[model samples]
Target: MKAQGIEVLLVFDPANMNYLTGYDGWSFYVPQLIVVALAEPEPLWIGRGIDLNGARETTYVEDANLYAYSDRYVHHDHRHPMDFVAHILRERELDNARIGLDMDSYYFSARGYEVLRRQMPHASFIDVTRLVSGLRSIKSPQELEYMRQAGQIMQRVMKVALGNVEPGIRQCDAVGEIYRAQMRGTQAYGGDYPAIAPMLPTGRGTSTPHLTWTDKPFVREEACILELAAARYHYHCPMARTVFMGDPPKRLVDAAMIVADGVQAALDAVKPGATCEAIEAAWRSVTAPRGIVKESRIGYSMGLNYPPDWGEHTMSLRPGDRSVLEPGMTFHLIPGIWMDDWGVEISESFVVTADGYELLAPFPRKLFVKP
Candidate 1:
């Protein structure tokens, strides 16, 4: 925040709220707010009375302010949630201060922005989404532990999924089986999004990277690509593997091998001084000449959330993105080879280290063939 000249960073989006407060509640539907006053002693959390206790217990924030709204009654017309936010800022004498707002982080309704603008007309609202994103790119020890647990859960789920792969099984059936296996007998299993349905794309459907599960039955010699996420500790790690039903075609096997090699190349390129674009380029070098056009980034930062604060949504395998690789940075290195008939996707979760990178998920990169 100091690097960006942001003295105060206020977050209201559910993901950012969770990142700041560590309070993962359904108050996302309500007016749950988190204010990080860097200059102050500690952060302030505001939420409904129902979520107060949970916020106090779960969140790292020590000082919490609770608000109770009437169920069947009408209160002061000026007691709306946005009004409360504005009141808090005013009470802190931050009306004219340069306040940073995460434009991409929070999904404020037009009414909410209008209320804020009207209330603090003198305050300078600057977009510090990138600043917050940069901060989130580097994971803390606790965040890394959560992500490691997420990777472990993904490995378990992948094992269950690969074991169930067989000829004549419907794609949806396999998906349902994986979800059941991952979600059973665990409380913190499916983090924020409880159910992450696996994508079992058979044959030509594997050509498309993000193929939806279909009713098509697995056929002999057809490639079955499974993509799934295991949600644990509110963090998710996406794992994908391509397998064949019968004796695999040599071309498919070779292509899958190339994709796996590309992932290794990308991981090998990860170090403290490497740029994001360069790391992606290294992965492409391993597969591009082998008739594979790299469609997307090789990887991106991961954290206590899936599609976390720092994601590959905007910054991608393009020029001018020189995000320096740093220790504690986690990324999903998904390198694939898209062929005319079939495709191969080998993805793994990795954490950047001082010298190199460490694979978080311990799943096999080899293509699994089920008889």
Candidate 2:
């Protein structure tokens, strides 16, 4: 908070709270937050009384710093938990201070903000949506280790997904195997639930992204794309690949090789002092020449996260994004090309190094074909 000149920071993003205080639980469904003031050494965690035990168990802070409201505030029409938070801030004389709130955060509800605003009318609220997020962009050595473990889990999960997808096999059956592998994870480590579910889009659905699986059985001469992630200690590594059940189409086959080459070229461009825009340019140079123009940003920063998405919402590997690359920064390079008929996505999760980028997974960088 001092580095950003923020006097008091109200962290409503669960990921930010987790990063700051090691407080982790399924309490984001409620109005919970971590309050940080420059003068205080430890952050204050507040939430429902029922979840107070979770905060104590997961966090390393002193018990005195934790506060809990009554269960009456859960869905109370007249009461809000922020009202109690404002009372604490007032006690600390922060009601008139410059307070930073994660206004754009998913966990920070519109009603929560309004209640806090009314409760602390004299306080000046600053839009510090990415304040803590910027600090989390770079991974520490321990954080990288967790991500590597997650990558190992993904390798096994992908293997199950690749093996079970076949003709006459229901999409849900293959997804079931993927789920089982995710739960079982690697031999050395167990898996945590990913931020997003597995995306198994086949045939026409592959033309569009973000579609989930169906009970429909696979057929001959069709394409299926698997985009899955594995989590270890809430650190994520997302990997995706497209597969063909039978003799794949010549056009898709050719596109697959081109996409593979483009991804490698982009990976090679990852070095310290390089710009994010330059990396996207390297990938586009290969595909644009072939008349393939992808409108979406190629990649984004990735790290510890909760459900709904795994992206860090910090930097994008695309034009207009001049965020300079630094060592320890991690990104998910999603070099996907979606045409009117079909789409191909072969991606990687990598960490930026001094010399180049290191891929999190040891999986092959080519499309998978099962005959």
Candidate 3:
């Protein structure tokens, strides 16, 4: 950024906040905070008093200005949070500076935008979200290790959950068992999202790839799909597997096998210099013959934050997304087949390498039928 003449960087979104400072909390309802990096000086953090300790402990920023409000008081009685943030920016003499703002992830509320506009009228705000995302796309060694651990845990939980699968079990019950199994380990917090809410889909419900868990129980020869995320040390590894309640109908099994083949083809295509479009095409080659039309990208990135603020949809799987397959880049390959009354999905996490990719989860892909 120094070579580009960028003087300061301001990060305000929750996702960016977590990325830069390990301050992970749902910040929507809370007062918005900003992490500012000046070219010469130490970084500064502007946040509410409630988050002071957390911000200090997790962030690299040493200078922190905090605004507090009395718990018993109403609006007019305390110092305004936005004003404090503005004051910090002004005190740093960053007004009129070329400031990089993470616009992709940071959306200012109407009032908050007005406050910044009034306070820093002279500053030019440039969108730097892409720069930051580009930097974040590749994982650090520590981040990769955490994701690998997350994958291991997910694989273990999958074994337990699949072993308990049977025709009589409700989808929700199976989901509950998986969640419980995940929680047994010390690393399990909540998932990147809810751990197991939209757990496994059964019967006709499998038609929707992201079908939420239902009270519907599994029946003989029906399709059942389990989509899950395992989070360890805040990193996530998302995976899915489809199975049968009994001996699955021959058609469903055939579809599952086709999807599995697509997944394998995608994994085989993953290597340095391979484009995302090329990977998607490999999967499409296998699925197209079986009449399974892909409506979404073949895969997406995985990281400390699953579904990292950017997703496969936002970053297309086209030729332009020349995000070369690099070592330490973790992604989820999800090849799905949508049918009239059911769908089959097989998702696995993989980390790109110099020659090939490493499969993070070692779970079985075949239809596991419960006796």
Candidate 4:
């Protein structure tokens, strides 16, 4: 924050909230925040009175740093919960400080920012959404263990989910099987809820990358793109593959080979001194000659996340992203292509190693063509 000239930070991103204090809950439906100031001994957690205990139970911080507002502030059209947070900031003598707000995050609602801006006229607010996000790009040993566990869970999940796919099974039923594997995890440990649910888009529906599953039955020759993550303690390991009900056409097989080769080239490009864009360029070099010009990014930095997203919004494996590769930084390298009539996704979640990068899950990186 000192680099950004931000003396006080108001963090509303749930992933960041979890990173800073280990506070976890589904209470993001309403207003809540984490306040960080230079002079403060501990960051403060402020939220609804009903959920204050939820914070206390989840966070390692002392009870003295927890503050809550009454229920009247919740769901009120005119009244907002951030007003209470602003009041506390003033009481703590941070009202006139150079405040920073996480304005670009999914959880930092416009109404919340408006209220904070109106409440603190004397304070300077700068957009610092990516400040904390950048700090979490590199994983510690413990965080890597949790991600490795998540990867193990995903390997089992992919095995069970793809094994159950057939011509007549409902897409929802297949997704249900994936969910079971996710919840059951390994026999050693249980799984945690994922940031996003199973994205098992079937048939030509795969052309749209983000569609959820439907109740429709799979037909012969149809394809399903399985985009899913198995999380352990909120650290996500996403895996994706294209599964076909019958013998896939040669076009798909060729595309699958291209994607796999491209992903490998990208992985080989990852090292301590490589740039993010250079890694993407390595993937692009393999596919560009095949007339596969993908506009979407092939990979991104990822780690601990919340609902609706699993990416660590700081860096991208794309053009102009100068962020150098570092050991222990994790990424989801998605060499997915959604053409007009078909789509194929064979992806990897990996962490940067001393020599190169390590794949989080050892699942086969191939398009599954089955009976």
Candidate 5:
């Protein structure tokens, strides 16, 4: 803030709030935020009165710094939570301060911004959407450990998903098992709810990504894609794989091999000084020779996030990114090929090491073919 000349910072992203104050709750559905003033000793937590206890329990914030509005402000046509927020700013003598706002966060609604802008017309708001997220690009030792644990849980989750998906099994039922394994986790520890739901795109649905499952039964010779993740204390490790119910087509097997090899080459290129685009270029070097033309990015920075996305919204492993890889940076390299009628996704999560890279999700890199 001192460098950016921001006297105040309004944090609206739930993940950012969690990262800052350890304030974890389901209160992000309504309006809630953390106010950081340069002159203040500690950040202030503001939200609904109903969630006040939740903030007190989860956050290390002092009771005096915790502020809450009445229930009447929730969902009311005329009464908005930002009005209360603006009032707090006035009380702090920061109504005219230069504030930084996370304008692009999923939780920062237009209505909330409009209300704040109108209520505090004297204050100048700057867009610092990527400021906090950029700081999260590198992981600490504890953060890396949590993500490693999440990867272990993710391996089990993928195993359950692969085992349940076979000829004649309902897609929805298979997804149910996947969800069970994701939450049940390993006996040593438990799993937290991931940011995204279990995506079980089966058969023709595999042609596109992000499709949820239905009650339809799996058929022979069709491909099924499982894109899932497991979280430990909100740290995530996402993995993806393709499954063939019966005798796999030659094209599918060959494509899977290409993807696996390409991902390996990409991981091999990861190091402290390498650029993000270098990894994508390594994968493209292998795939392009095999007539594979993928326009989408191969991977992205990911960790410590909430619903709607687990991606860090920072560096991306694709052409023109040019962001230099660091030792503690982590990424999910999911190179999925979507054809007109079928698709295959083979992915891996890894952390950049001083020498190279270490795979987080320790799973087989081949397509599973069930006879």
Candidate 6:
């Protein structure tokens, strides 16, 4: 904030709110803010009166720094929680200070921004998008440990998904088994809810990513894509694999080999001095010759997050992203191809080591052909 000349930062992203103050709750349905100021030693947590105690229990913030608005402000037409936030800013003499807002964050709703902007017209608001998230890109020792545990859970989760997806099985039933594996986890520690639900795109649905399940049963000779994650303490480790119910077509077999090779080439290109785009170039070199031209990025930085997404939104493996690679940075290298009526996906979540990279999930990086 000192470098950006932002005197006050209104942190609305729940992951960021957790990163700064260790405040975690499902109260983000309404308005909430972590009022961070240069003058104050402790950041203030402002939210609904009902969640005040939750913040006190989950966060290290002092009682004096925790403020809550009455029930009237929640979903009320006459008032908003930002009004209460503005009053607090006035009390701290920060009403006129330069403020920073995460404009692109999913949690920072437009109505909330409009209310805060209208309430504090004197303050200069800067769009500091990805500022806090960038800080969270590199994993700390403890954060890496949590992610490793999440990866261990992911190994079991993926095995369950691969085993459950077979001929004559309902897509919903397969996902049910997956959910049980995700929640029951290993005998050691249980799993937390992933930011994204299990993406079980089957047959034609496989041509497009991000589709959930249906009651339809799997047919022989059709393909299914299993994209799922396992989380531990809010830290997520996601993985994807393709499954074939019967004899695989030669076209898909060749494509799967190309994807596997491209993924490995990208991983082999990782080093301390390499850029994000260079890693993408390595994958492109392998795919361009095979007539695969993917417009979407192959990989992205990911870690601690909430519902809707698990990516860090900081950096990505694509053309022109010149972000330098550094040790301790984790990424999901999901290089997939979706054609007109068929698709194949194979991915790996790995962390950058000092010399190279290490795969998080100890699973096979190949398409599973269930005969």
**Which is the winner by TM-score between candidate 1 and candidate 5?**
5
Off by over 4 Å in 2: none
Candidate 1 off by > 4 Å = 62-64, 67-80, 184-197, 211-221, 247-251, 306-319, 337-342
**Model 4, runs deviating above 4 Å:** none
The TM-score, computed over Cα atoms with residue i paired to residue i, of candidate 2 is 0.97
Q: All candidates' TM-scores? A: 0.83, 0.97, 0.84, 0.98, 0.98, 0.98
Give the per-residue lDDT digits (tens) of candidate 6, residues 34-56.
Answer: 98999999899999999999998
Give a tens-digit lDDT track for model 2, residues 1-371. 66666799999888999999998988898889999888788889988899999998999878988989988888889998888888888887878888998788998888888998999888888888788899999999999999999999999999899999898999999999998988788778899989999998899888987999999999888999999999998899999999998898888988889888889889999999999999999999988898667889999999999988899998999999999999999999998888887989999999999899899987987778888
Q: Ten residues in a row with the worst lDDT in model 1? A: 67-76
lDDT of 3 by residue, 83-140 (tens): 6566677876776688776665534455555566677888777767656555666788
Can you list the residue pairs that collide in candidate 2? none
CA lDDT for candidate 4? 0.90
Candidate 1 lDDT by residue in tens digits, 111-184: 66677888889887877765555567777887777777777777777887887777777767777778776665
- Model 3 stretches astray by more than 4 angstroms: 2-5, 26-31, 63-83, 106-111, 186-198, 219-221, 306-320
Per-residue C-alpha lDDT of model 4 across residues 1-371, encoded as one tens digit per residue: 89999899988889999999998999988888899999898999998898888998999878888999989998898999988888999999989989988788877788888898899999888988789988999999999999999999999999998887788888888888999999899999889999998897788788888999788888898898989999999999999999988888888888998999999999989999899999999999998898677888888999999988999888899999999989999999997899887999999999999989899998888889886
Runs in model 5 deviating more than 4 A are: none
Q: What's the CA RMSD of model 4 in angstroms? A: 0.9
Candidate 5 lDDT, 230-336, residue by residue in tens: 99999999999999988988889999999999999999899999999999999999999998879999999999999989999989899999999998899999999
**lDDT per prediction?**
0.70, 0.90, 0.68, 0.90, 0.92, 0.92
lDDT of 6 at 313: 91
Clash totals, every prediction: 0, 0, 0, 0, 0, 0
Candidate 2 CA-lDDT value: 0.90
Which residue pairs overlap in candidate 5's backbone? none
